[model samples]
Target: MTATIEQPTKVRRPRATLQLLRITLVLHALLIVAQPIAAGYFLAGNVDAMTDIHATIGGSVWIVAFLQTIVAACYTIAGHGRLWPTITSAALVIAEFVQLTFGYAQNFAVHVPLGTAIVTAVVWMTVWSFRSTARLSRREAKR
Candidate 1:
């Protein structure tokens, strides 16, 4: 039997990449929540009680969010996808500042819900934009 290679599907945003982006957004959002909770604990009792887990999670989330930021930029630079590109860029900007301002990666004591809400809203907007743009393009193509 002769073996044949199947060509990979062509897509502006592949399933895996989209899934990764989604996961990164979710993780970052969770960090936004976790940071405030951790701060509450620190305020209530001992600051020493905070563990490396906070830092580790925050760091990993930061990296993931950074990667998504790059992906969003790429999507815009390439000009292949229009809908999510705009939303993603906005979200990335907010996320980057939030991470830096809140000191989420460096310390959990600083929690900024303003930034969190901005990022969260942008994430959902990006998702909605992606779906709407996709549908619009399909419809346009049919005509």
Candidate 2:
């Protein structure tokens, strides 16, 4: 005769705070993606109207950055996200401010590469947030 034992399984519940964070991350990624497209249209002379659209998109990035910071705070306070995401989000806000400054000053040397880096970073974070179950579990464990 053999005795078999089954271990208890841990069930994870989806939290609204995490859901909000995920939504914000997705929006941030979209905003980051749009900025370059708008700039490209303006630079290519495809449309003179694209200049205003580009500036509008650039300004909107600041609003998204602010939203990201708030959502990061909510996630941290709720113990649903790790410290790194919040830290990176905060850093990105600062970087965006600098990027805006350089852009307004027409300093393409810093503005172009910085914009590229921002887009890459935001996209990476958005993908990671969507795919990292381990991170989600670890963060929930801290609660």
Off by over 4 Å in 1: 1-16, 49-60, 74-79, 83-115, 122-143
Top-TM-score structure, candidate number: 2
lDDT of 1 by residue, 1-143 (tens): 99999997554433444444455556556665565566567678866535554445545555556665776544444534444544555666666567655664554344555545545664564465446343233224245
Give lDDT for model 1: 0.53
Off by over 4 Å in 2: 1-14, 47-50, 134-143
Residue-pair clashes per candidate:
0, 0
TM-score, every prediction: 0.49, 0.80
Q: How close is candidate 1 to the true structure, as a TM-score?
A: 0.49
Error of 2 at 88 (Å): 0.5
Q: Which 10 residues in a row give candidate 2 its minimum summed lDDT?
A: 132-141
- Tens-place lDDT digits, model 2, residues 1-143: 99999987664433665677789989989888988888888777867535577676787787788888888777766644566777888999999999888888889999999999999989987887777552464436566
Give the Å error, residue 51, model 1.
5.7
